[model samples]
Target: MASRKPSTDDTTHKLKEDLHHLTQTIEDLVSATADDSRSNIKELRARAEKRLKETRDRLESRGERLYDEARDSVTHQVDACDRYVHDNPWTSVGLGAAAGIVIGMLIGRR
Candidate 1:
């Protein structure tokens, strides 16, 4: 079975969603501060900072996870190809030659 790569579009969409939610949270926090006393304002500020920190941490963790997943996927593909070539060296060689010739001809036609 072949491993499927993650979609960049999905990742981008998720990031946009996260940002949108964060923006909404900030806007709400700002508007909610209008009727608050000094102590309440300080409390809201602390909560806002905490929320921002949590969002940052979540985004960083997600980005790291995606990077690791992509790296592992590529490594797995290369390992599979290496095993296939080892098991069928002659076939691999012929395929490589054919690919090279095709590429050369394509380049020549340019």
Candidate 2:
């Protein structure tokens, strides 16, 4: 079976969950430090810092992936449009002229 790439919504949801987990971890660390004098503050701090670093790395990687996905999608669309225009030059020209005329009429009214 082929693995599927996650959609934008899925990625966004995962990021939100990661952020929430990070927030919870920090909160726990704070509460633990404040509540117990004998508690291992160093271990708690280390864990919180590790979580924060992991979340930051995940966010950075996801942002880069999102940027690359958007760029690729736009490039694909532009290529498809270029192909269509080349294949149907006259139709594309007519459509462009029609759109321009419509815009001109709308602007003239204003």
Clash totals, every prediction = 0, 0
**What lDDT does model 2 reach?**
0.91
lDDT of each residue in 5-106, candidate 1, tens digit only? 558897788778777777877776787788757776777677777777877987898889888988999999999999999999999999999999999999
Best by TM-score: 2
- Expressed as tens digits, the lDDT of each residue in 1-110 for candidate 2 is 99999987998899999999889888988888886755577778888899999999998998898899899999999999999999999999999999999999999998
Where model 1 places Cα greater than 4 Å from the true spot, the runs are 1-21, 32-37
Q: Where is the poorest 10-residue window by lDDT in model 1? A: 35-44
| Per-candidate TM-score against the hidden true structure | 0.71, 0.84
Where does candidate 2 stray beyond 4 Å?
35-39
The Cα local distance difference test for each model comes to: 0.84, 0.91
RMSD of 1: 5.4
